[model samples]
Target: MFIRAESKALNEAIAPALCAVSAKNTVAVLECLYLNAEDGKLTVIGYDNSKGMKTSCDADIIESGCILVKGMKFAGIIKMMPQGEITIATDERNNVSISSGKTKFEIAGMSGDIFPALPELVSEKGITLSQAFLKKMISQTIFSYAQTDIKPVYMGILFEFKDSELRVCSCDGYRISFCKAPFSSGESLTERFIVPGKTLTELQKLLKDDDTPVNIELTRRHIVFSFNGLFFFSRLMEGEFLDYENSFQKVFKTYITVDISELIDSIERAGLIIDDKMKTAIKFIIYGDVLQIKTATETGKIDEEITAEVEGEDLTIGFNHRYIIEALKGAQISGDDKIVMSLNTPFSGMVITPVDHEDYKYMILPVRM
Candidate 1:
């Protein structure tokens, strides 16, 4: 393919497409990226058997053709090249010649005709949601996703769309984390599916903090995301997601409202005494108008108190301070906002929600003292 494009723009297209490149394969056609230069546009495509990505860059196409080059090698060459225009051409022998202002290089490439083809998405309705919202939802919940390979279903984040509200939930058995974003109006996009945590993570990296709409299309076996001239495709897992909504149906006997930063600071200090080996717990001595965080070890101990607005009965509870800290960070709480904590007993999971909103919910199971 004879395509002359600016090095900066070329790299931008290559980088995103590499998200789907098979890093596991040391050899084979899967190691290369498909480059098609035609109709005044240069499109780069990469696909593993499961996921794929395609990105387009504006280029000066002198001759319309297609070729495949080692994905990482080609990306590395472009990455180090100067910022000026770069010309790439593939001859009949499948040798690729790439050069910019002063430097030039030639490399072996594969014929694009033999590359694996991507699946054709069935004609279905597409849903549009903001990039900023999707990014926030994933960040707030993905941390709690299951890491083990035993239960493959738990390794994914659930995308639940029901009654117009989208809730993303992740759990590692010990805790459940979730966030919600409203879909203002759409052409009846309602369904539930699990997207692998790793896939969500890669997609999150590409999402900017803007309000740019991300178009989503899904079928029984595959899901596609398109935005800003970039296309992402991922295979859907075959299983039903956990019933996350049922976890929030419990009755709460105690509710405490405290400053978000103050509780976070106290939890941070309490976590200092505990490490992975030590396995310490932060005991919460809840009583009239005050919440105390206490952590003790053979080496040392810590105790911190902060004023809280408590209602219902007073009780002492214990929890892993790390969960509270992570949840607080994910919730993105501010000074003006208060944290609402709900509890039934020391054995039940403590629910944490930010003031005046159901946008996010964090749950932490108590650690027995």
Candidate 2:
């Protein structure tokens, strides 16, 4: 393969695709980026069997061919090259040469024929939404996904489309993050799938916060996301996601509305004295329009109070500090925005929702103190 392209354009195409390339893989080709130069463009692909990303950029294709080069090294070389044009070529021996104005380097490459083939990108079942909306939905829920592999099913975020609404949910046994928005596909589509958290994390980085639409396609076993000349696909997790709709409590004995920033600051202050190694729980005493936050450890103790609009029966509850902080932060609340907290018992999960809308809900299991 021989191609000439601007360094900036090449970096833009190669950088995002590297997210799918594993640093070390048992399959040698999985660690390499497949470069196919043809038809006046250079297409770069990185696949690690479970998920993959492909992107293309305009290039001067001297010869229509393909080769595989080490993903990390090639990306590094392109990024560090001079600001002008870059030329990449390969010989019969599979030796790859990358050069800029006054510098050049040679590296070993493998035939592109050995790289794993990506899944088919077309499907009849799919939805199109603005990149900003999808990015926000993923950011709000991804925090609750399981970080461990003990429950493989919980390690992904669930995407459910029904009744012209799309709901995204994630749970990690201790807490649940849920967000939904109205979506009209005109086809009355009802579909559900689970995408691995790792895939969404990388996708989030590439997603631009704009009005550009992202086309999502779902096959029997894979999900594809296409936007701005980039194709990202990941294998869908097998098995049923938790029935999250029914898990949230509908009744509450205590309700409190407080400023989002004030509450977050109080909890973060309490977190300062609590050590992760001790597994400490922050105690909340809510009564008479005042919420008292308290926590103590060998390091120190904190007692802080914040004003709130309290209703129903007053209650004292305990929760893992980190869980509460993460849940609040994930809400994407801003200044002057208030959140309502509802609780039934010390053991029941605390449900949080914005004071103005019900579009997002976060539930955290209370710690037994």
Candidate 3:
């Protein structure tokens, strides 16, 4: 296989695909990037059996063929090369040569036929959304995704589409995040799917904060996202996600409205003295119009107070420092200066929402003090 491509365009196309290349895989082919030169285009693919990405760039195709090259090494070579046309060629023995301007390099490649086949890209069910909207939804809720594999379903974010509205929900054992937006498909369509958190993390990096549209196709066991000459597909987790709609408490005994930045700053100050070795819970003492933040550990203790609009009964709650801080940060993403915190008791979870609208909701369970 032989082809000539511009260094910048080739590097940009190869960057996102590398997210699927396994760093430590038993199969060598899974660690390499599959390169197919055909129809005057250079197609690059990276797959580790579960999730993968494919992207193409225009190239001067000399002899159409396919080969697999080490993902990192090949990308590095292309990225460091001069800003000009790069010549890539492979011989019968799979010895690859890369040359541009006066610089040249050679690496070993394997036959692309040995790589695992990707899932079919065709799907009857599909939806289109703006990249910016999708990116914001994921950013607000992905933090609650389970990092462990104890429950396979919790490791993904649930996507629910119905009645011209789209909702995304995610939950770790200790907290839950929910976000929704209006969606128009121009036809009657209802679909629900869970995309692995790892896939969304990588897809978020490739998505731009603009109005560019992204087309999403969904099947029973597979999902595909197409945009800007890129096709990303992943296997869906088959299980029932948590019923997040009913997880949040509807009634609260205590409610407070406080500045988001001030609350985050107070929590960060309390976290400074706590570490992994010290499992101390941050205590919140709310009464009248003052919210006191306190934490005591082997290292030290912090007693900070911030003013807020408090109503209902005075409540005292204890929570993990990291969990509350993360929940607060996630709430801040709504671009709101003030947030409302609703609480029921010392044991019940605390709910955080924006002052104006309910576009996002985050809940954090308190810890035993």
Candidate 4:
């Protein structure tokens, strides 16, 4: 399409949408960014078939047209160009030209007719939540999403909306993270969706402010996130998430409250030594009023004890150091000056809560060292 826009504004729109571009694209059109111009504004869209993103910026339309240009090359050009007006146009021969000031670049574009049709947002089941609350929920749980594809369903985060709250959960079998926030009334009559972790992270990055509210719509196959002139859509994973609630049954035989930073530092240092081990488990040894974290490996052994208000039965439990570190790093601990961890056995899920946040909770499944 023929349109003129500022370089920085164009880059801002292109960067987030480009996250959907697939490196191993099976279709040639999936590798390009689709541009559509209508009335006075131009819209940029990108999708790798499974996930799609659409974003728009104010533009001066000279001619109305649509075309698909190579995503990487277009993004690279936009990012390198200085702050100035950029003019983009496509000819009858499908040649695309991008010009800014004294420089101009031309690249061949494909017909937009071949691009996959975007899924419509079915508003039948949806909810409205503050961007601030949703952002916190995503950041805290997304790290637990599985990185492996052995179990395809585990690779994404689960969104369960029922009654009046949205619960976001993720687990790779070894660790599970759960967070929930209240939803507005008259939302989500009946529905649940599992969104891929990659998609959620992109949405999290695109949201620049916390004051804005995000509109989330869910269909049987796709979930749509809309805010601030941007629309993000992702294909939902198609399997049942594990029965997460049932796994919480194991009571805490021993619970302790310790400094959040101190606990994080202790585990991180222990990980330096545990890095050589295959399991990377850190042993938590608790006595009367203190707790000690230790891990051993070929390099050396790390041992650190932190003061805590320990009660109940004194016990030791093994946990995957990676999971604990991930949860603690983003914790919002307050009031009590300590992080609370409850555990029954290394095989059961361990619950970590910030003393500051009564509504927020983090769960991690421990590993045998």
Candidate 5:
């Protein structure tokens, strides 16, 4: 392939695309990125048989050709090159040459025709959402995604749509997060699809936070996200996501309203003493208006009391301190406001929300550290 492109554009194109390249693959071609030069444009493609990415940029193409270059080697070389026009060409012997300014580098490549084809998406349902809204939904819930190999279905986030609202839910059996966004116009439909956390995370990194709209198209087995001159595809996790909404049917035994920052700080400070093997067991003891948060380990213990407007009888609940801390941080807490935590039991879901806004709710189940 013979192509001439600016260094910055080439680097931008490769940075996000290379993320899907397999670091350890049985198939040698999966470790390489396909570079195609055609019709005044250069396209870089990378995939590991499951997730894939494609990005294109305008370039001066002297000859139309295709080559597959090692992802790591190509990325490293391009990153170190000067910020100017770069010339890349592949010879008949399969040697790829890269030149910019006065420096030149050569590397071997495989024929691009041998690279596996990226999955072709068949869109049965499609929606458009603002980039900022999509980013928020991903950030608020993605951290709680399942990672265990036993249930491959749980290792992803659930996407649900109804009328003009979209919701993203994620959980790892310990805690669950749900975030919703408004869709201005769309057919009234309710469909649940599970998407791996890694895919949403990659989108979060690439999607801009501006007001641009992003198009999301989905079929039975795959999903495609096109935004900001980037195309991302991910294999959907098959099987049913556990029924999350049913957990909210019961009432909480105790409800406490405290500052979000205050509770987060207390969890962080108290969790330090709870060793990993012991499950970071931090206890919340509520008596009248005083709420005490404490944790103990073999070597040390931390205890702190925060005044809260508590309701119902006194209760003490044990929970994973790290989970509570992270959950508190994820909630969309408002300025100088008290956040409410409605607790039913350590085994049940605890609903959290800012006192000022009822539109958003965060639920996290207590871990029996």
Candidate 6:
């Protein structure tokens, strides 16, 4: 393919597509980015066996052709090149040429035909939602996936849609992230899909603007997201995720309403005394309108208390530091914003929600300290 594109335009388009380049590939071509230039447009595609991303850019197409080149290296050279148009061309020998200003380089490339075909579902009708909401949903949930592959299915974030409400959920056995956002669907839809945590991480990068709408298409085996002329495809996880609705049924023995920043600040300051070398749990002692946070080890200790609105019962509980830390982060609460936490016992999960916001909930499992 012979095409000319501005350095900024080409670099921006190529960056997101590189997210799908297989980290480990047995086939040489799988590591290459597929480039197709035709009719004044250039299309870039990267695909691992499981996930893929494709993006297009306006280019001066001198000829209609296709080629495959190392995706990362090409992107690097384009990014480093001076701010000017870069010309890319492929020779009959399957070698690729890149030139900008006074610099030029040739890289070996392969036939684009050898690459696995990208999904072709352009004609299918898909749901549309605000890019900002999609980005927020992924950010709030993706972090809660279990780090281990012990429960492979638990390593994904679930997208459940029914009754015209879309819910995004993630849980690692110990803590759960739940966020619900309403959207107008293009058609009547009731479905559930588990998307791997890594896919959403990359999607966060691609879906940059909140004002734009994102088009999403789902198939039996894959889900496709399109926004800003970029297409992202991911293979759906192959198992049924836990029915998360049942997890929130446990009633609270005690519920506390606390300022988001005050609670987060106290937990963070208390965490400083925790020993990095051992498993540590933060203790919460609640009574009246005061909440005490304390943790200790051979090195030192921290005992701190902050104001809270307490009801039902005075309770004491212990939990791993990470659970609460991440839960606070996922809640995305700000100054003056309040959070309500429900606790049954040290053994039951503690569900935390932003006051007045029923659609968002973050749960952390307590520990025995």
How are the candidates ranked when ordered by lDDT, highest leading? 3, 2, 1, 6, 5, 4
TM-scores, each model vs. reference: 0.89, 0.96, 0.97, 0.91, 0.94, 0.92
Candidate 5 positional error at 239, Å: 0.7
The TM-score between candidate 3 and the true structure equals 0.97
Q: Write the per-residue lDDT of candidate 4 for residues 152-189, one digit (tens) a residue.
A: 89889988776677777888877778776666456335
Q: Which digits, one per residue and each the tens of the lDDT, describe model 1 over residues 83-200? A: 8999999999999999988799899999999988888878465687899888888898978888996778888889888788898999888789988877645466677888888788
Q: Write the per-residue lDDT of candidate 6 for residues 1-369, one digit (tens) a residue.
A: 888999888988899889998645787777789999998889899988788988888999998899988887888888888898999999999989899888998989998888887665544446888898888888778778878899999888899887789999988888888888776576777878898888888888878756798888887778899888888999889787878888874788889998877888888887787775686889999999999998887768889889889988888899888678777777763222888889887778889887877778888878888
Question: Which candidate comes out best when scored by TM-score?
Answer: 3
Single out the weakest 10-residue window by summed lDDT for candidate 1. 328-337
Q: How many residue pairs clash in model 6? A: 0
Per-residue error at 367 for model 3, in Å?
Answer: 0.3
Residue 238, model 2: lDDT of 83
What is every candidate's alpha-carbon RMSD to the true fold? 2.6, 1.5, 1.2, 2.4, 2.0, 2.2
How close to the true structure is residue 91 of candidate 5, measured as C-alpha lDDT?
95
Between candidates 3 and 6, name the one with more favorable TM-score: 3
The weakest ten consecutive residues by lDDT in model 2 span 327-336
Clashes of each: 0, 0, 0, 1, 0, 0
Candidate 4, residue 367: lDDT = 67
Ranking by TM-score: 3, 2, 5, 6, 4, 1
Task: Please report the TM-score between candidate 6 and the true structure.
Answer: 0.92
In model 2, where do residues sit more than 4 Å from their true spots? 25-27, 333-336
After superposition, the stretches of candidate 3 with alpha carbons farther than 4 Å from their true spots are none
lDDT tens readout by residue for model 2, 142-245: 88899998899999999999778999999999999998888889688888899999899989998999999999999899999999889999999987898999
lDDT of 5 by residue, 1-369 (tens): 788999999998998898788776788898898999999999999988788999988899999899999998899999999889999999998899999989999999988889888787889988778898888778888788887867778789998886667877887877777766666545666777888888888889888878898888888899888888888889998887878777553587888989788787788888677787868678888889988988878969898999999997687788877777766767743233578888876667678776876435667766564
- As a whole number from 0 to 100, the lDDT of residue 183 in candidate 6 is 62
